[model samples]
Target: MMEERKIGRKTDLRVLKTQKAIKDAFKEMVMEMDASQITVKELSERAQIHRKTFYLHYTTIEALFEDIMKDLFQEYCRLIEQTAPDAPFDEVNRVFFTFMSRQEPYMERMVCAPSYRDFSDKLFMTMMIHNRSRYNPYANYSKEEQNVINTFLCLTSVNIYRQWVKDGKVLSLEDLIELTNRLFLHGISDVRHDL
Candidate 1:
């Protein structure tokens, strides 16, 4: 029994390492080429793993992409939770952008990727479901209204990030955050008020 347990633990560790290597290779490939262009054979070679091992973990490249997106979303959620425990939505947004700015290279690639729209939509939904109490700005609204507001917020924020990345991030992180906050919180009224 003791020997079996030891062997099982060893197998688990090996599996984890294999998966990490595969993921790392995938990330590197994605940074260089479009995700749709990456093949399982190339991925396996890059990871230094057998093709059968790749099949053991993921059935398709799309599945692997989804898994990676899921992992990234989970990490984003963890950053939010860690940075501002029980904080309000605005504060959570601040913490989120701060965390994302630190992950600029990864974020830029992911946001600009061809699969980004679907990935972002799914990630937004996951975050909404996972942190309903913390991130729901439409808690008092009806279900339909909540959906509309949530969609608007997600699209707006994502577009802003995409533009920032496309512009080569000319603005500092602080400036970017302030711009986001101004647009989301005060809207055009702040600039109009000055006029």
Candidate 2:
């Protein structure tokens, strides 16, 4: 869905403030609990907006989360396009990890914290969906096949990214990206004869 369609106006200060407040409230609640556990009633109260206002802005918690993620995803994708136009799928992880590492402090808590693994997964899944046209060569594959491939790549990458964050990023971003690339390409059965 278009962000513009969901948000009726961008130029109005009241609209911008309401959006920010809603996002800020979502972030705070997300840090405290899983995304699934949050409710519009609680979120609206926290944002100091009525539930109707929240509904006017977001139909569901997931929509709100996706909206927030799309903004970040677009920012990083722009940077990646500039720096690595037509970069291979493996290299895409580098930009993603770097982008995650550079997120604002409030986002760090929401994106990096262990309790928010779902958020991290959602973010990576969003990237995979958005990244398909630009990076996927398997577009010729059947729809089911594409889903399987996308699911494996997204979940595997998100888990690795999560572990890296939980372990305090012992591996440098480049190293971590390289690790994921190897796993994605080789898929553990490095010995082709065994497969």
Candidate 3:
């Protein structure tokens, strides 16, 4: 069983607003410089909040980065859940690509920035943790094997997405989704598994 922490509605609203401001500031700052270059002082100044208030919400910039990743992962899970259980690969891919397309600029900056490579790696690991069950069909394999497979798949997907963003998304959303699905499902194997 899990314990729930309760807070007054007013306090909850204030916390949410402050967190959003901090995130917005971070995003804006990332566009200008690397995450490593973003100091708490600068972030607080950009967010128009005191440095102590930032500390109250997050212990460090890395914590804030993790929180942002958590938000994205949750949003992705929500979108995936909304998809029908029997949804075809194309449908699921459409949903995912649509979400990614909307967040393209921010994602591109985050992934391409050298200083944030560690953060990107951590984000991928976090996503893999959240998605492990979805990839666990080969029950005969050991946990380590399953983890290796999952990590490979996740890294491949991330690289493809990074490439798409780097290319300025020349392909239409639907086309990109189809391309990604086809590549992942078939992988030049010539075997046509109806994904």
Candidate 4:
């Protein structure tokens, strides 16, 4: 399990914050440059950190990616927890809408860079994996059945999020949730088949 180390309480929290700032800066800078063309000096300058400090936290620009990917996954998981399983569709939609309201900006920035595309793929993978395990804890389905539902959700949810972002976030959070719930809960054959 990934330990939730609260860096804020420690002296090194500042260092951690600085590292985050550097990475955030790097992310913004890379959006404007080819990842292959981004040099350590440029990244350091963008992040406002000394070259030595950047090196201390990461060996190369690529190494910073691993850490950022981990953070992206963690953030998504945090958002998923804010949603309620038993809530009405509108309520659930609100939960997701609220979640996206917070994430839309960061995602918009991250997706602009070529280096961050894989992070988007991994984000979908992580959500699918999580949903398969915990989405409906009350449903006693076989593993194969669960896998099918997870796969469907994985595709639909990712697409919805992508569309939501692309649509300039026109829908209210509640509307997004209601639409999703209508599709999943009320639209299709409610009877889930194992096949």
lDDT of 3 by residue, 40-86 (tens): 99999999999999999999999998888777788878887776655
Which stretches in model 1 have alpha-carbon errors above 4 Å?
Answer: 83-86, 133-135, 192-195
**In model 3, what lDDT does residue 191 have?**
41
Cα lDDT tens digits, model 2, 144-183, are: 9999989987787766766787798788988877777777
Write the number of the candidate with greater TM-score, choosing between 1 and 2: 1
Best by TM-score: 1
Worst 10 residues of 2 by lDDT: 186-195
Where model 2 places Cα greater than 4 Å from the true spot, the runs are 1-11, 83-85, 105-122, 186-195
- Please, what is the whole-model Cα lDDT of each candidate in the order they appear? 0.77, 0.77, 0.76, 0.66
Candidate 1 lDDT (Cα, 0 to 1): 0.77
Arrange candidates by lDDT, highest first: which order? 2, 1, 3, 4
Residue 108, candidate 4: C-alpha displacement in angstroms: 2.4
Q: Could you tell me the lDDT of residue 119 within candidate 2? A: 61
lDDT of 4 at 71: 77
Write down the lDDT that model 3 would get: 0.76
The CA lDDT at 49 in model 4 is 82
